[model samples]
Each structure stands twice: as C-alpha cells, then as structure tokens.
Target: MSGMSSTQPWDVQRLPRADDKVFLITGGNAGIGYFVAEQLSGTGATVVLGSRNPAKAEVAMAAIRSRVSSARVRAVRLDLADLSSLRTAVESMEVDRLDAVVHNAGVALDAPPRRETGDGHELMFGTNHLGHFALTQWLMPLLSTAPAARIVTTGSFAAKSERLDLDDLHSRQGYRPKRAYGRSKLAQMYFGLELDRRLRAVDSTVASVVVHPGGALDSLTPSRPPVHARTTGAWLRMAPAALLVHGKHAGAWPAVRAVLDPSVRGGQLWGPRIFGLRGKPCREPVWSQLTDTSVAARLWDASCDLTGVDLGTIPG
Candidate 1:
C-alpha cells in the first residue's frame, strides 16, 4: 500500500467537484461528522447525514442548507449501537450507487463499568467496530455498483497506546474508558486495512481507508446555526486554543481527504501533518499492532461472529 508523506502539502481548497456523487456519513449531526458533511455538500455531493436523533439530524441539515444554499443534503435515523437500526437505515436509503460511506459515528468516551450495546457486546467496541462492520457488509451491494467506492473509517490517536486483547475483547475482565476507546479505534483501523486486502483479493474496485480527526475541540469551533451549546467545560473553553487542538473544521480534513483525494489508495492511513494531533491532513504511520495481518484476520472473524453479518460471501 502507498503512504502519504508530510513533505507533500495537500490543499483542501483543491477538492474536485463531486457533482453527482452520493455519500452517507454516520453521526453527521455534530462534531467532525458535521464539518465533513458540510465540506462534501459544498462540493455538490448529495449527502445523507445519519444520526440516532431525528431532531439533531434536522438541525444539522438546516445548518448545512443555510451555509451552502446549493447544498444537496438530507438526514436519516441510524443508531450504530443497534444492528436492526443499521439494516433499516440502509434499506430506507434510495441510493443506487453509493460513492462512499464514512463510518464516523462512535462512542468516544468509555463507561466506568463498561456498557453493552443492544447486541450484547461492549458499548465502545460494539458501536465503533461491530456496528461499522455490519454496516459496510449491508452496504456492499450499493458500494459495488459504483464505478469506484471508498469506505473511510474514522480512527483515533489513542490507538497508538492500546492493543486488542482477543481473550477479553469485550472487556469482561476489566475496563478503563481511555483503554476501551483506544481498543475500539485499533479495531477500526485493522478492519479498514483488512477490508482493503480482501477487496484486492477479489479484484473489487472498492477502497477502504482509515483516517483520524486530530484533536478537534468544540470550544474552538466557530458557532454555527441551530444554536447548540459547546460541550467543553467553561474553563477549557476560556483558555487559549491549545496548539494540539485544531478545532472541528480542521479536524474533518483527513476524513475528507480519505474520501475525495484521488491519490489516496486502499490500505492507507491519513491523519494530521503535525505529530498526528494537529495540522493539515497527510499520510501517517499506523501502529505496528494494527498492521498485523494475523490479528486483523482474527478481528474480522470475531466481528462477523459477534455482528452475525458476513462480508466474505459478498459477490465481487
């Protein structure tokens, strides 16, 4: 797989026109997902913002329309924590050919005692990894129909410090919020890379890429429509923007690049240019654990078993 180097400067302003393309972004109502939807819609792509809350989705859609008068965007109810909801959301879509699916929805924080999704798996792992795992499987047909489709899974910087424990995949033994979040991210990256390998083996045109929004802070983000309050604490909100926290708009760049950059290929990981926390989108090194083929294969098997969705049999 080819890698993006920091030496090459990528200009977000140069994104090519996406006139008739269609994209579905999970958790597009706020945070980096909202910015990603805005950026894609600005380029003329039809965007579907998937969120669990209808009200929030509507607010996000309104905001997008207000900003880009010509924006073609809509909202759909999608709960990543529930497999049934994911399937229903896909069935409800009118998409004949999906250009890309941005798996951006996830549980960012860990629960003190560890939580489980409706599917009976750890909340963070289930929502972040298993949910996306099932979603991509269900959307394979739409993706395959497109001339060239991309699957951009959002990972995190925390992945660098955490490794998956196959025996305790669900955190049955013990749990820490930060570690749980890291494990989920590591799984996401592994899945993205492994998916790329599988697609190549089947000679399919679909590309799978992993991207991380650097440290994006709500306090630093410019206020927009819908009048939503900042989620950050007042103390941090008042402090000068940290060098590592590059606000939501800048953070969305890596995912946007993974989606639209013609030069980006399957199996490549993209992140911030400055130490993975801030700066423009660029290629970055993945953790060695995430690159382990054996581990990825094992993860793929476990995901299938847990989600009860199989991508292996999908026609190429």
Candidate 2:
C-alpha cells in the first residue's frame, strides 16, 4: 500500500523507496513498460525486464542505466505468445521472492489477417490475457513469499465498452482486428479483478490491481534513441492531442503507482485523471463490463484448461 488517505492528494511524481524489493515487468523493453521499468529502477529496486528479445532487452537496460545512475536493472526473455517456455523463464529469474510483477506487455494488431500464437490460439487473446494468466499462476509461489506482493495488470481503456462473448472467446465464429483486440484486453481486466477476489477469499498477501494507460501516442512519447525516435514534425503534429492524451511515459503512471503506492488496494482500477483519457493517475470506479462475475468464472475455468494453470490453487 502507498498513500492511504482518501482525502489527501497523491503526487504521481513522488514514489516511496523500494530498495529491498524486486519488481518484474513483462515487455519492459519498450513503450509504457519501458518507462515503468525506468521509474521503478530509479527507486533503487531490482527491476527485471521480461522481454522476448535479448538484444532489445539489453538496449532497454542500457537506456535505463544512462537515464538513472546506479539503477538496479536486468532482463529475462519472456514471450507471452509461447506457453511451454513460461515455467522455464520463471525459474530463470533466479529470485526467491518477488515484490511485484507488472503485466504490462501485450499485442494489438491494426488490421486482420488474424494470427494465432504458438499454442494455436488467437494471437491477441493468447498473448495478452492467457499468457499473463499462466505467468501469474507460475509466479504465485514467489509472490506468496513476499511480505506484501502486487500483480499489476495493464488493462486498456478500450475494454470499458466491450463485453466478453465467452462462447466464442477466440473470435473463431467471427473476427475483426478491433473487436478481438478489445475483447482480449477486457479478458485481462476481468482476470485481474477476479484474481483480487480470489486472493482475498484465500487471505493471501498478494494483491491484484488493474490499470489502463489512457490514450498514448508514439508522437507524444519521448525519443530514447536506438529504440524509439519521433521526428520533430510528428511531435508538433500531435501537440494538439497532448492537451487530452499523453505520451507512453505519462501513461505509465498508474501502473507505477500500483506497485509502489501503499494506498492502492486490490481490485481497484486506476487510470489517467482527466475524463479517463489523460492527466495524472487517479483511482476510478470499476467499469460495469468488468464486474460480471459469471463471465469471469467461466473465463477462469477456460483459461485453466487452455494454459493448464489452476487459478483455484493460487498460492497464499
């Protein structure tokens, strides 16, 4: 927990020290995940970037080191699209206790010629939701070992209006890039909330918190050369949108707070403060679409079957 007073204002820039803690961020090699890693590493915590590309991961680490002096950071290869390799990846982390894990990485395809993962499931749903689901199950033991652990699922603003069609969860009957992408994120948000309920029911110390980076644009995000670069014209063109939305770094606030904020409770939803689209991080009421327990339970069971992870047996 971070700042507990409901009446007191929270400063998104100021974070509590986490020198002895260990935090893992899936896909921390780029975008919002990269900023999340950079911010946490600045806290003196050991930050492990879960990336699929070793070279890209090292580049991200180097960027962080350049930005933050004495930053404690490293990387572990993690490709959510592959299920068989997850357990091995977790073991490779070589950490006994994990204070927090930010489920921040995902895939979003713009146009469809829909793709499936190595496990033969729709790419977005498989990687965004189920991948994190399996990874969470595998990390339960380490999370349980921490005095107080957090599972920060990076949800999406797109999920606010989408409803799950559990019957055709993979969009086999029909598929649109937009709908599939929305549903995948909605599923992950559901998983995050359901996990909160499960952990509480079991009296576990591990907490699950969901966050969405409002609207973020590549043009708005700052350049960190060799990885991301934006032309001055692009930045200027997007400047008008900046009044409402943010760059990827700003989008990272809510998730960063979820890991370090003492006041943020499990099952809570956080996002940008202005119109749920832009501004500093703030707690928001759970979207009605996200509260359907019946759908959540069904998806939980289906996820267990697909990934072979028993959420019913979540540790601690």
Candidate 3:
C-alpha cells in the first residue's frame, strides 16, 4: 500500500532496483513500455522486449544496450492480435524460465464499424484481453519453474465504466468502439484476479497482479472517441477538471511496482498515488464491486472457452 508522494513527480530513474531476474515486457519498445524495459534492463535483469514491430523493438533494444552495455536483453516478435502469433512467440523463446511477464501490450480501434479477430471475437477484446489470456496460459510452465513469477497486466481507470456484458461479449449486438475497449480492459483485470484464484487453489508458485497505468501516452490511443475511452481532447473540451489529473508516466509506475514491489499481494490492484488516475505506484481499490468473485469467475470460464486454453490444466 506504500507509494511515492502524490504531490511529487516521478520518472523511470526513480524505479526500484531489479536484479537477477528475467522479465518479458510486452509493447516494451516505445513510450511507457519502452522506459519500463529500459529501467529493468539497467538494473541487470535479463529483459526481453515483446514487440509486434521488429524494427521498432530493435531500435529500442539498441538504445538500452547503449546505456547499459552489459544489459542482457533481446527483442522477441509478438503480436497479440493473433493467437497463433502469441503461441509462436512463446514457443520461439530460448529461455528456460521467466520471473515476470508484463502484459503491457494493448490496442484501441476507435474508428470502428467494428472488426473481429479471426476467432470471430471483437478486435479490441481479442488483442487486449483474449490474446494475453492465451499467452499467459501458454507460458505457465516456464513461469511456474521460476521461484516466483508475476503476471502484471496493464489496466485502466476507464475500467470503471466497463461491464462484462456476457450476452454481447463480442459487442456484435451493439458495437460501440469505446465500450468494446473498456470491456476488453475489464476482461484483462478479470483474468488477472481469476488467474490468481486458480493459481492459489492449485498451490501454484506463480502470482498474478493487475496494475493500471491510470493514464498514459501510447500507440493504443483511439483515433476517435470510443463510447467511454478517455482522451486528452475530450478532457480538455468537456471536463477541464480532468486536466488537473496527469497520466504521463502512469504506465511506468504501476508496471514497475507490479513487477518489483515485494509487498504486492496476489490479485491486488495497483495504480497511481493520485485519485486513481495518475502519479506514483500505489495500491488502489478495485474500481468496481462487480469485479468480485462471480464476475471474475464467469470471465475466466468465458476466456477459457473463447481461447480454448485452460490455466487450471497447467502443472504447477
């Protein structure tokens, strides 16, 4: 529950030291994700950047190497939009085990008449939630091998506005760009909590933690407002009060805390120290009471059904 002061500014340089562990950070080649990779790599951890774009990943890796010549780092191609790509990426890794898998990759298709993945699920839901769900399921063995493994998912405050509409999960019944994005993120959080429960029940060594960046600048920004997608443009126009809230490095803080905080509890949520929007890493309340047992369990079952993957079957 401890964190940096809410009134103070924080950056990657202030991150806790991480040593002698291996970390795989998705979307780690740019922006907040990039900085997270850089910080962990600097601390002498074996850092792998999970990137969809090879060239961009390479560039980011090169920069990190320049700063820390001994940084044991590499870039692995990973596109969460495709489940096969997720499987292939994990399969391709030569490493024996991973200490943490930071689910930092996400996307928001705001300009939408609604698109679905190859599996016929909504695009946002596929890439943001289902894909990561599958990836985590696939990586259980390697994660279980490590002394303590953490699955740190990047969620959002916008999750407050999202509900897992089981009747219309694909959002085909009513395709709203923003709503789909929120549902996808909410599902990600659901997966985090449910996965934790499953791991505990099985006495698995690995732990699952859900972290929200609160707000951040990233490639996932929607071109147009999804039903409830938060954006600077909207905040600036409709709600000036939101401007007082900052999200610049919200992604970096929660990610660092989730991966590094010894105090982080399984199934606990972390975000900025501020009013749940932005600041330093800190334990925060789950945004919705609906994210409790019934919802998380249902989402877990639905995820296993949708992705055709099961976390429970994996050996501890």
Candidate achieving the largest lDDT: 2
Per-residue CA lDDT of candidate 2, range 278-315, in tens? 98999999998788898888999999999988879876
TM-score of each: 0.93, 0.97, 0.85
Q: Any runs in candidate 1 off by more than 4 Å, and if so which? A: 1-9, 227-241
Better candidate by lDDT, 1 or 2: 2
Write down the worst ten-residue block by lDDT for model 3: 219-228
**C-alpha lDDT of residue 297 in model 1:** 97
lDDT of 1 by residue, 120-173 (tens): 998999999999999998889999998888999999888888889988889888
lDDT by candidate, in order shown: 0.86, 0.92, 0.77
* Best-to-worst TM-score order: 2, 1, 3
- Residue pairs in collision within model 2: 1-261, 1-262, 2-261, 2-262, 2-263
* RMSD of model 2 against the true structure: 1.4
- How far is 149's C-alpha from truth in model 2 (Å)? 0.3
